[model samples]
Each structure stands twice: as C-alpha cells, then as structure tokens.
Target: MALDDIRARIRAAEAAAGRPPGSVTLIAVSKLQPADRVEAALDQGQRVFGENYVQEAQRKWPAWRARWPEVALHMIGPLQSNKARAAVELFDAIHGVDRASLARRLARVAQETGLAPQVFVQVNTGAEPQKAGVLPAEADALIQECRQLGLNLAGCMCIPPDDADPRPHFQLLRETATRNGLSGLSMGMSADFETAIAEGATHVRVGSAIFGARPTERPG
Candidate 1:
C-alpha cells in the first residue's frame, strides 16, 4: 500500500498547490531495487519508473516491458555520452541531459533511429562542484542548445544540495524551464517531492518510499 500512499500524497500535494488533479507524474525510482519489488509496484498500476543506469535497465526492463507494455521508463541519473543511443532506445524520457556533448550525441542517435526520448536539462541549482548538472548560470545556453539540436527538449531537472532547503533549487529549475518555454520540471525525490510539486514540478521521482530501501551492493 506504500505505492498507493505515495500516490495519495501526490494528489494531496497537487490539490494543495492549486494544480489540476493528476498534473504531476510520479516516476517510481526503481533503480537498484529487486525484481519482486518492481513487479509489485507494476502490478499496483505504477507504469512509470526511473532507472539510474543504462546497462541495469537493459538487463531487467525488456522482459518486464513485454509483460507490461504500457510502462514508461525514465533515465534519472547521470547519463554518459556513450550510452546516449541505448538511453534513447530504452527510455521514454531522459532527465539528466546536462551537457552540450550529451545533447549532441542524443541528437545523433535520434537521427539514426528516427526516435528520441523526451529530455530534461539537468541544472545544478546548488552549484555543487561534484554534481553532474549544468550550473544555474549555464542552464539557458544548454536549453537553447538542446532545442537547436532538434531534440525534444521537454524541461529542466535538478538535485538540490543534500543539506540545504530544496525549495529554492526547485524554484530555480521551474524558472529556468519557464524562461526556456518548457513545462516539464523533473526536480523532486521522496524527501522533498511535496515541496517540488508545490513549486510546479511536473514529474517527481520517488524510490525508497515506494519500493523500499535498495541493497547496499549492486549486482554486476
């Protein structure tokens, strides 16, 4: 019933934010979770899931997709340029497009395959040195570049500083998306999704709250 609870919370957040019901998409972050956990969520009508790694998704999702054809998979972690083709082929949306090189690669893949996933430019609102997103100051250029590349530039995504308030970061992402004429805001996770929804997040990636904790050691 955790999935249902999370959905209920999302609905409440939507209502409280004065947004239309079902305005926010809940992407169950299933990366690193056990197959059974994922299946249970799928059975509960969770059709959208987020994965962090291309290889992991490739290994596990095809069979699952065969069984649940309506499923929508999203790439929510750092995406490497080398994996752009696979990510384009496998995911319905990519939420970590943070650089021009990756954007160009995605465009090339789209040209080759005649298919491209919706993409969100990742913004490092916190300006964290170690994070894998474009800095807030550089977001517009990247967004412009992505649009120029003929990619389906949907919106913006962000991971706020771990120890700081996330609402400001969410606000920055929302503002950036608005300036770029984008509507999608993939800027929330389990801990701060409500705040993100309040700040106009169109997609919230929630993991542990839905599927429980991930194992410490990932299988190769």
Candidate 2:
C-alpha cells in the first residue's frame, strides 16, 4: 500500500508536469534502511535503489544481488576518494561524483575493475561551503574534465539549501544539463521531489517516502 501510494504520487507529479509516466526514474534511496524493506519495494517492481555509505552498500548489495541480480544500485551520498575502489566495485551508477580528483580516482578504479560505472557530476547549486560538490560556476568545466578523464558523465546532481525554494535549483540544473547536452539529472528527494519532477528531474532519490524515516545508526 505504501509503495502504491508513492507510485501514485510519482504518476500524478509526472502528469502535472506534462511528462509521460515513463520519463522519470524513481531511485528508491535505501540508505540506513535494511534489506527487507528494500525487498518489499522490489516486490512492487522497483528495480533501482540508492545507497549512501560504501560499507553499508557493500554489506547489502551481494545479498540483494543474489536475490535480484537485475536490480540497479546507485551511490547517492558524499563519496570520499578512499571509498572509490569499493564504490566502483559495488554500485551500478554513482550520483555524487563531485570533485575532479574523485572522478579521476573512480575512473582509474573502474578501469582496473573493468566496470564502467555510470556517474553524475554533483554541483553545489547553493554554494554551501560544507557540501561535497563543485561550485555552480565551476560545474561545466569540471564536467567537461570528467568526460575527458574517460568517466561516463551521465549528468548532474544537487542538494538545495534548506531554507530556499528548491524549484529554482532544480530549474537551474535542468537548464544546465540541457545547455551542456547532458541527459541525466539525479536531483530531488522525498520533501521536494514533486516540484523536482515538475521541473524535469530524470531521477528522483526518495527514501523516507518509501521506507519511512531512516533508522538511526548504531555507533560501532
């Protein structure tokens, strides 16, 4: 029932945006959530799931893969260069390839692993000093550089400022992708995903809407 509700909202958002239902990909963000919950979503025919931590995903992916080999996995959190090898080995697509150094490392790791992982260049649309993305002004050049590094530059991703209207950020990303000839935009999450879909979000990372509030992590 919960999955259906989420699906209905997705459909309505697509219709409201004048986009076909098939246009958007719903990336169920299962970060901090257990595999059983993911299996439930899978039972509803959802194939793409996004994970944050490399270690967490490493623990989850193999079991899930054994059960559902065709499922697509996306790395949707801040990725450190240290985790590049594991991330390249685990995720099918990575949504947070923000830095040029990280992109180079990921490309090298992918080359060694013989896995051409799809990637999104994250842009700090809000220019938040603490965020893990290239500043908005520098995004295009960085993306071009990533392309030159032999990384599969799929598109862009962004996290809007908490107090601002996310629509403008979404609009800017969509416009940038269009102007730059990029086709993927992995923007939007549970709170403002409807607005994102309205503004041309090719991929929406929704976690709580599907899996309930994320569980608090236990300190090891």
Candidate 3:
C-alpha cells in the first residue's frame, strides 16, 4: 500500500511539473532500514537509496552492493570533516555539504579516490539552530568556494521547518540554483515532495512512503 502510494505521488508530482516521470529521481531514504527491506525495495525497482550516518552506511552498503551491484547510495546526513575520507570512499553522492572547508576535504578525498561523487550543498532555509546546513544567504558563496576547490557542485538541498509551507523554501532553493547557474535541486521528502516538484526539485528523498515507518532506534 505504501509503495503504491509513493508511486502515485511520484506520478502526480511529475505530471504537475510537466516533466517526464523519469526526470525526477526518487531516492528512497533507508537510513534506519535493514538490508532485507532494501533488497525488497530493490526488487520493486528502487535503484537509489539514501543513508544518514557514515558508520551505518558503511555497514549496510557493502551487503546491499554484494546483492545488487547497480544500487546507488547517497549520503544525506550531517558529514563531519573526519568522516570525509570514508564518505567519499563509500557513497555515490553526498548531499549535506554546507561549509567550504568540508567541501574542500571532500574534494581532496574524491581526487585521491579517483571517484567524483555528485555533491550537493545543503542550505538551512529555515535557519534552524540545530540543523546542519549553511544559511540560505551564504549558499552562493559556498558554491563558488566549492567550485574553486574542484568539488562538482551538482545542486542545492534544504529541509524546511516542519510546520511551515515548504513551497516557499523549495522556490527559494530553485531560485538560488538558477541564479548560480546550477541545474539540480535536491529538496523535498515524503511530506512535501509535491511542493518541491512544483518548485523545480530534480530529486526527492522519500523514506516512510517507500520503506514503511522507520524502526525505533536502540539505546546507544
């Protein structure tokens, strides 16, 4: 039921955006999900998945790769500078690059690894104090700095405040990308992906809609 709903939403969003459904990449966020669930989704034709923690991703990705070599993994969490090497080594894309220093580190790691994983700048559109992203106003400068460091800036990403309408945030991100001459906007999620699509999001990270409710975290 959830998977069907997700497919329906994707279809509707693409139609509303006047884009071919294939143009928007649906990244199934499988941060807390186990490999079996990921394999099931793979069987259902989901080729892209996102993980949050580097350690968790490092543990889960290899098994998934062993079973399905074509699966693409994206890192969609706050990446620490110390974790840059492992992140560059493991994931196919990094979506939480918010600072120039981190971008430089990632670029260096990518260069050393000889694998240029796609990179996205995460912007704190809502300016939440606890979030891990650059303030929206600083995004352009960060992008330029990243380009100077040889990081392939594919697009921008944002997570709007939970209660606010996400359309404005999505619109802002789209405008930011356009102003900077970038093409990708990796905004939106299960709740607000339609708004993101309408506002020109090229990628949407969906979790519960595709993977069911996330499993409860065990006490650390």
Candidate 4:
C-alpha cells in the first residue's frame, strides 16, 4: 500500500511538473531492506532499486538478475575506488562517482569487463566539506574528465543540505546537467522528491517513503 501510494504521488508530481507520465525514475532505496522485501516490491511491478553498500548488493542481486532481467540496480551511495570492478559489473548505473580517482578506476574496470554502467557525477551543491560529491566549482571539469575516460557519464546527482529547501540545490544540478549536455538529474529523496521533480529531476532516490525506514537509521 505504501509503495502504491508513493507511485501515485510520483505520477502526480510528474504531471504537475508538465513532464510526461512516467518521466521520472523511482529508485526504491533498498539499502537495508532484506531480499524478501525487494522481491515483494518486484512482484508489485517496481523494478528500479538503489543500494547504498556494494557488499550488500553483491550478496543480494545476482540471483535476481537471472530471474528478473528487467530489474535495474543503481548504486546511490558513496562508492569506493577498490570496489570499482564490482560496481561496474553489478549495477546498471551509479549515482556516486564523485572524483577523478574513482572515475578512473571505473573506467579501467569497464575496459576490462567490456561494460560501462551508466554514471552520474555527484555534486556537493551545499559545499559541505564532509560530503562525498565534487564541489559545485569542480563539477564541470570532473564530469568532463569522467566522460573523457570513456565512462558512460549519464548526468549529475546531488544531495541537498538536509533540512534546508532543496529546490536551489535541485536547480543547480539541473543547470549543471544542461550546461554539460547531460540528460539525467538524480536529485531529491524521500522528503523533497516533489520539489526535485518540479526542478527537473529525471530520477529521485526514495527510501522511507516506499520501504518504511532504514534498519539502521541515519539522516537522509
């Protein structure tokens, strides 16, 4: 019922934004949710999923890939360079390529695997030093560098300052993607997704709104 409600809300948001029906991608953040829960959502016709940890996803998704080939997994948390090969081979796209080093590793992995999952350069739009995204000032160069490395750079992603109006950050990410000729905007989350859609988000990473809450709670 919650997933249905969230999908209804997503459709409403998309329509209100003047986007075509189903223009937005809803990534059920299945980070701490168990495999059974994910399979239930799949039964309900939800296919796109997001995972925060590589190790956890690796443990869960391989079986599903054979059974539900249409399901897509997105890496929506900070990615480690050491896990580049696993990330490339496991995910359909990653929303957390935040630096040149990580991008380079992914590129190398792609060269070896003959596959490059789609990628989005995370931007620290709020300029928070502790975050994983590239600073807004550095986003362009980083995106360019990632693209040049032959990675399938899809667009841009951002996490707005928590408890603040996320519209500005959403707008910034939208603008950055437009300037770089990128098409995807992986912005917004459980709380601000509607505003994200209004600001041109093509993908929103929603967790609690659909899956209840994280088993180990953290600030969104």
Runs off by more than 4 Å, candidate 2:
218-220
Worst 10 residues of 4 by lDDT: 211-220
lDDT of 2 by residue, 1-220 (tens): 2778877898999999898978889899888886678888988898999988888888777987888899999999999999999988888899898888898898899789899889998988989898888888888888888888898788999989999999999988888788789989888888998999988899999989889976788312
Tell me the deviation in Å of residue 134 in model 1.
0.3
Instruction: State the displacement of the C-alpha of residue 170, model 3, in Å, after optimal TM-score superposition.
Output: 0.4
- Point out where model 3 deviates above 4 Å: 218-220
Query: Model 2 Cα displacement at 115 (Å)?
Result: 0.9
Q: Model 3 over residues 1-220: C-alpha lDDT tens digits?
A: 2666787888898998798877788899988886678778888888888988899888777876887889989999999999999998888899999998899899888888898889999999999999989998899999999889888789999999999999889988988889999999999999888888888888999998777887889312
Ranking by lDDT: 1, 4, 3, 2
The candidate scoring highest on lDDT is: 1
Question: lDDT of each structure?
Answer: 0.93, 0.87, 0.88, 0.91
The residue pairs found clashing in candidate 2 are none
